[model samples]
Target: MGTSYWRGELWLGPDYGLVQGQLGHTTAHAHYAHQLIIAVGSPVTVELDGVRHSGHCLLIPALQRHAMVQAPDPAFSLYAEPLRIAASDLQRCVEGVEASLPKLQAALEQCPRQPIADPRVERALQALDATLEGKVAATQLAAEAHVSLSQLERLFSRDVGLSVRRLVLWRRLRLAMALVLQGQSMTQAAHGAGFADSAHCSRTLKALFGVSAGQALKTLNPRLLA
Candidate 1:
């Protein structure tokens, strides 16, 4: 057995993403995006709020603390922004063990799109996305959204289900992962993603996804599609 476990395809995007392959174990963590895990070949185990869940299909809401206790070989994990993807939409994609990648993707394609109700929040998100490679301040984002700092925070909470800081961190992780896919070292990726150091990046990665930067790169080898 090796540390490298994941295989197959990985598609990284700003609002939605997918990674499929020999799944890797993950520690308890919560993220800003909704997660859907559909197992292939065998069932996967997920632990949420101290309770363990095992099945071929599992859906987790944004910011809900959970962990992948056991991710068996061949699994498709989807991440969608809660602002755009409704929980009910993801529920329809849960088709158990018989679910194939094509079927799951088709379901995802058919999922209804929800426009962000708040223009301020939309502006803030776009501003944040554009500045992930550099330093960003809360006040700066508030200015971009044309709202006060406190009001911006409220807008993010009501529309995105998490703090703007946490969302920025999550997007930074995605950028770091993309840099890794482009052949950059973890240290380089960390700096490129505006982290203080590689150790900082690694800690954040492990905290969120239960995998180290080096481990993720190895696991995703030759299969990552950015």
Candidate 2:
């Protein structure tokens, strides 16, 4: 295994994001969005549901347990929300040997601008986005969406590809990661992101990205791009 130093730049959009820079191995984890990882300098190996896959570019479906078993010095990871961009569209943009970061960014820019048709689901998602600190509950989101708890849950699964709880946690994790990258202490980041404590945040970090908060803070000096 190589050093765990992963310096990178993160560009965030409304429904998509891109991370480009040095990357290392990741522990087994899963995400709520479709991910396309393009290796730099050399081929990379990924462990998907315990199966090993090696390629210069790999696409992991939403919610599939996987890990980067091996990666080169630099890599480009693109995360696209399932609702905003179809998997085939994303794949086609990065296909063959000419794939690059600019191409992926262009792909994101080309995504359909149309909003979700379901007003309730959109309202619920807006509520979650408004509360990135994890301060809101499902019941509150349901209320915001003007739906029952069961209906909200059903709508989330149908439209968001995740449960309300998972979406909340994912949003918090993103906030916590950004805080950590910005030089906050684990405890501070944890609290700032609405985690109960540093321990809970650490556990969630490892579970989600297969890295500890300390390691991420120390190693992943991600520059947030405008």
Candidate 3:
């Protein structure tokens, strides 16, 4: 069967469950209580420990702290119990999570901590860091690197823990935040970030950060903005 764009759910433990049925931006606030495992069909950018990732899958440790910003395309997410898998087993578990949701549920029976090396996906990271305020496409990046789009996807999955499109979205979000910090109006930020309008920017910011642009800016420490 073909993947359905509008069909997706969130598998929290037996106690918690969520079903998403919309085509808009989504965001989870910084949570320190539960680890989260997210699966996406489109590209998605995740910010954790001050780093941004885009690619296939993401594993966020509980109490470690992070934020998720969805890409423009529709996506799906699953949140499992932190104790279900150890740190060392994260990679394998993430790789297998979607294939057998039931097995993943069973594996969560034992929460083991496995330590894995960072994927160290740097080329795309460098490109994003350099062009946060500019317009760039995954195809362009792949071409520049002399790799096909699929190869870039594999590299992003293996090294960055996300996808190329997600990285772009994340970069746009970051740029939006920076513009807001600079005292730009919502309209200005939206236009600067290549969004259609202020409302579009507001929707995305709210979905990813769980706050409107005004609210987010108010919470920023003045020193950090400066």
Candidate 4:
């Protein structure tokens, strides 16, 4: 069988994003965004920390490593903002993904964690998101968040499921993915996304997402950005 996947729809924003598609063989990798996926027709399976999870619907939290293969069938998956996805929202959001794209978007946008949210961490994350190039100092970010460096680190780990260092690189890779779609060379995309070089970008992508940047582009197509 030919091993290319066609994306159905892609919705991306600073806070949350979702993409759905048919899938082929995929390497194991972990990402910063919490993920939810459902099979459109046949069942999908994901390998988690140890056991294999196979089902019609499931959600995987941020930073928890997993690898997925779509069983040569139709599939869809949603990546939610880790901090925004509440325990209560998982079922509803997964349902929303299957129901309608708009509903999925709306479900993703609901601010359930608004009151309990910390603005410092939010600002820090925003800073990380905008960091398309170069390293931003943790001290500078801590100052921006009005917290001590230690406090900021703790908050990031608690809320984002990653340290500030990891999140920064995660944002860079994400930016690189977009730049790749715009026809930038992998080397160009790497430099633009703040990596040392294309080799560094390739290694990071393979380590974190279990595929090279080129392989990812071949595996899935982005049908929509917003």
| Top-scoring candidate (TM-score) | 1
Quote each prediction's TM-score: 0.86, 0.84, 0.45, 0.80
Is 3 or 4 the stronger prediction by TM-score? Answer: 4
Ten contiguous residues minimizing lDDT sum, candidate 1: 217-226
TM-score: the better of candidates 2 and 4:
2
Q: Could you tell me which 10 consecutive residues in candidate 2 have the lowest summed lDDT?
A: 217-226
Cα displacement (Å) at residue 167, model 1: 1.6
So what's the TM-score on candidate 2? 0.84
lDDT of 2 at 203: 87
Error of 2 at 28 (Å): 1.4
lDDT against the true structure, each candidate: 0.77, 0.77, 0.52, 0.70
Candidate achieving higher lDDT, 1 or 3: 1
* Count of backbone clashes, every candidate in sequence: 0, 0, 18, 0
Q: Candidate 3, 42: how far from true, in Å?
A: 39
Give the per-residue lDDT of model 3 (tens digit) for 15-51: 1122232223324454212343344456567667767
Q: Order the numbered candidates by TM-score, best leading.
A: 1, 2, 4, 3
